[model samples]
Structures are given as structure tokens and as C-alpha cells.
Target: GRGFYSPSDATKWVAYESEPAQLLTIGLGVGLFAGGLGVMLGAPGVFLAFGITAASLVFLQFGVAVPVSHHIALPAAIAAAASGSVIWGGLVGVACAFVGEFMARTFLCHGDTHIDPPAAAITVMTTVVNAAAAFGFFALAKLPA
Candidate 1:
């Protein structure tokens, strides 16, 4: 017997999963994973320094089903970490500041100003970094404990 299978059927697919718990758990796991990657790459401080600050912005502005952005800050962070120098953090921070400012002016400040360029940039950059970090860290973590 053929029945009327509506689009709403798809929406009801995950009815058993709690949305808030799912979102929070995923967010927390991602935060910890990203932070851990920063730490493992020889930059212990980056977990708090850049991880919290940059990753938050990226997650909020461009995470999930969004247009995506410039948050590819991991490489810079990795370099900074490898250097074992606070000076490197300062340098990368300054560079990111300039990039954020330029993005704000060139994109966010136009017309209705609906989008936040700095946040978008940071978010997208971090997203790419996180993806790379996840894969890289996964490979490293799988080295048989």
C-alpha cells in the first residue's frame, strides 16, 4: 500500500535525540579537541590563548549550516606554538587583527551591514583549522598507546 510520505517525516527522523544535549556535547567536544590540538602541537598556552578566543567566534558565526569564512587560524597558531615564544603569539595576533579589520571594512561595513566580517573570517579560518587538526590529531592519537 502506497502512503503519503511527507517532508515532515524526515524532520521527525531524530526525534529521540535531545537537541540541546547534542549541540552542547558536540560543542564541548569540539572545543576540547581543538584546544587539545593546539596544546599537542607544542603550544600549551594556545588552548586558552587562541583556541578559546578564535574558535568561539568561528563556531558562532560560521559553524553548522552557514556561508562559512576566514578562520583558518590553525597554521598560524601551530607555528606560534612550535616557536615556544609569546612573541610569536603577539605577531600572529597582530596579523589577525589587521586581517579582521580589513575584512570588516571591505565586506561587513557595506550596504545593510547584515554580516559580521571579522567574525565570519575568524569562524571560517578556525573551521578549516579544526578540520585539519582533527584529522592530523586523529592520526597522531592513533599511534598505539
Candidate 2:
């Protein structure tokens, strides 16, 4: 009950009205679409890395902001909790993949040192994506349905 809203709290009225399932489904659809776009754009097979990075971001957010929609049914609440991450992660994955591809061609082409520029690029991009997702999620979650 640590994250649960009190039964008498007025804030929970919004949680009951929010459409969490729709939000989650939208995120999933967007993510898959973005993946397809990445493939078409000739990203350098970074889907696995992208997924891992996204998952990490989602996990971190879950830890930091553990919101509980106690008014909603269990399944719906879970979906709502999950949708934020899925949507954000997918967007980040696609954006990072595109940027990583560009970095690979631009700065990573130099084979002078042992540093893998592509990996570094992905790492930096992931950090930015995570930060963006965190802020975006916080803002979006606070908005009324």
C-alpha cells in the first residue's frame, strides 16, 4: 500500500477515469512502428541494444516513481503503469537507433583507437533518452484524462 492512494483521497478520481489500457496500447503500437522505420532507415542492427536500453529506463522509472492507481482494477492499473515505459522506450529506441547510425558513419568511421564509437554513442544517447522519458512520463502522468 506504500504507493496506493488513500481510499478517501480525491486524487484517485482521476486515476479511475484515466484510460491506461489505451495509453499502453498506443505506446506499443508506436514502438513497433518505430522499429520498422529504423530498419528501413538502415540502422546498424542495434535493436537488441535499443531494447535493453529502453527496458533499463523503464525499470529505473518504476523504481523512482511508484504510482499506484488503487481505484482502478488490478489489470488496468498494471497496464497503465506499463504503458508509460513502453511508449517512451520505443520512442527512445527509434531515436537512438537513427542517431547511432549517423554517429557510426560520421565519427565512428575512424578506426584509429580501440574505442567502439558506436557503443559509446548508444550509451550517451540512451542516457539522454532516459532523462527525457523520465521527465515526459512525469508530466504526462500528471495531466488529466
Candidate 3:
């Protein structure tokens, strides 16, 4: 009798699949909260504020990985920073929606199959979450403290 062969998993694949969901959840929460504080404080809060902004922006960008890359006349570092802030922050809702859809298709079904109903629901939920975070920041900024 022969035994079935099991293939060894690669580092990236193992890491990607094994990565804790809590990490992403916590990262998003912390990023939004810190970023909100940064925006509210202004000037002096630049480090933590922009740092959170940059992290969230990158997370959203990686989540979507949209194809279009536009160039501006600003200096290289500034242009990259501005692009990340404007594009990612501006589109976080939509990007998260897409990510939700992708996650549903990949995880819930355990196959490549896509169900429109669930995908739409997930997208809407993601959009709401992103929008809430954005508006929450705006609201927090208005408070005097």
C-alpha cells in the first residue's frame, strides 16, 4: 500500500493564508483612530497623524491593487505621499468594497465560484465600514479637547 503525497507549502502561501484576521482588524482600528487624532490636532501631530494616514493608505492600496498609476509634477517623495493620501483615502470605501467581495468569493465558498448576492452584501458592508471611519474622523476633529 502507498501513501498519498503531500506537497510542502511555500513561505508566502503559508504566511498569506495563516495571517491572523485580528491583525488586520486591529491595524484598521488603530490606523483610523490615530489618523483621526492626527488630523484633529494639526501641525504638531504630523508624525503619528501622517504615519497612520500613510499606513491606512497603503493598506487600502494593497487591498485593491488598482491598475492605473497617474503621475503628478510634484517631487518624487511628495508625489508618492500625496498620491497615496489622495487616491487611497479618497477611494477607501470603494476599495474596501472590492476587497470584501474578493474575500467572500475566496473564503466563504472555499472555491473560485462567485455568488453575486453575497458579494454585493459584503461590498456594501465594507463600504459602510470605510465611510463610518472617515466620517468618524471628521466628527472627532470637530470636538474641542
Best by lDDT: 1
* Candidate 2 TM-score, C-alpha based: 0.35
Please write out the lDDT profile of model 2 over residues 36-131, one tens digit for every residue. Answer: 433333233234423433444465455543222111111111222333333333544344434443443344333344444336544665455445
Per-residue lDDT tens digits of candidate 1, residues 1-145?
Answer: 3222221323321222213354234333333343344445655555444555554556555434321212323434543444433333333344444444445445544334456654665665556444645576434433211
Give the TM-score (vs. native) of candidate 1: 0.37
Superior by lDDT: candidate 1 or candidate 2? 1
lDDT of 3 by residue, 88-130 (tens): 2223323332343344434443434544422453345434534
Worst 10 residues of 3 by lDDT: 68-77
TM-score comparison, 1 vs 2, better candidate = 1
**RMSD from true fold, candidate 1:** 15.9
Best by TM-score: 1
Error of 3 at 135 (Å): 18
True-structure lDDT of candidate 3 = 0.33
Give the count of colliding residue pairs in each prediction. Answer: 7, 0, 0
Better of 2 and 3 by lDDT: 2
> What are the runs in model 2 whose C-alpha is more than 4 Å off?
1-85, 133-138, 141-145
Error of 1 at 133 (Å): 13
Better of 1 and 3 by lDDT: 1
lDDT of 1: 0.41
